[model samples]
Target: MQANIGTIDRALRVVAGILLIALSLFGVIGLWGWIGVVPLATGLFSFCPAYRLLGLSTCKRCQ
Candidate 1:
């Protein structure tokens, strides 16, 4: 699939995901922290299913 997520967006997602997972590992949250993988994977791939379904794109001209 074409990339709809930009570098900044992906970076944010990765940061958010890492934070969520870290919180879980540190006992700051429960199993919900595992959900962090969603953002992590999407960030790494620079594509999001929800974005695709909604026809959204965050990629700039650089992409």
Candidate 2:
């Protein structure tokens, strides 16, 4: 899939994802923190299925 996430968006997602996973691992959150995997995956790949479905893209290049 094409990259639909912008640089800043990707960076935020990565940071947020890492924080969530870290919190989960540290027992600060819960198993639900594992959901961070979704953001991590989408960030790393620079693609978002939801954005695709909504016909939206944060990447200026993609637009």
Candidate 3:
């Protein structure tokens, strides 16, 4: 799929995802934090299914 996530967005997602996962692993948050995997995967892949569904894209290059 084409990359619909921008550099900044991707970076933020990765950071947030990592933070959530870390918190979960450290028992600082509930297992729900494991959901961070979604953002992590999307960020790494630079593709967001929701964005695609909504016909939105944060990457200017894609426009």
Off by over 4 Å in 3: none
Question: What TM-score would every model get versus the actual structure?
Answer: 0.91, 0.96, 0.97
Ranking by TM-score: 3, 2, 1
Candidates 2 and 3: which is better by TM-score? 3
Q: How well does candidate 2 score on lDDT at residue 16?
A: 93
Q: Identify the candidate with maximal TM-score.
A: 3
Ten residues in sequence with the least summed lDDT for candidate 2: 54-63
- For model 3, residues 1-63, the per-residue Cα lDDT tens digits are 999999999999999999999999999998989999999999999999999999999999998
Comparing 1 and 2 on TM-score, the stronger one: 2
TM-score of candidate 3 against the unseen true structure: 0.97
At residue 48, candidate 1 shows an lDDT of 94
Give the alpha carbon lDDT tens digit for every residue of 1-63 in model 2: 889999999999999999999999999999999999999999999999999999999999888
The candidate that wins on lDDT is 3
Assess candidate 1 and give its TM-score to the true structure: 0.91
lDDT of 1 by residue, 1-63 (tens): 788899899999999999999999999998899899999999999889999999788988535
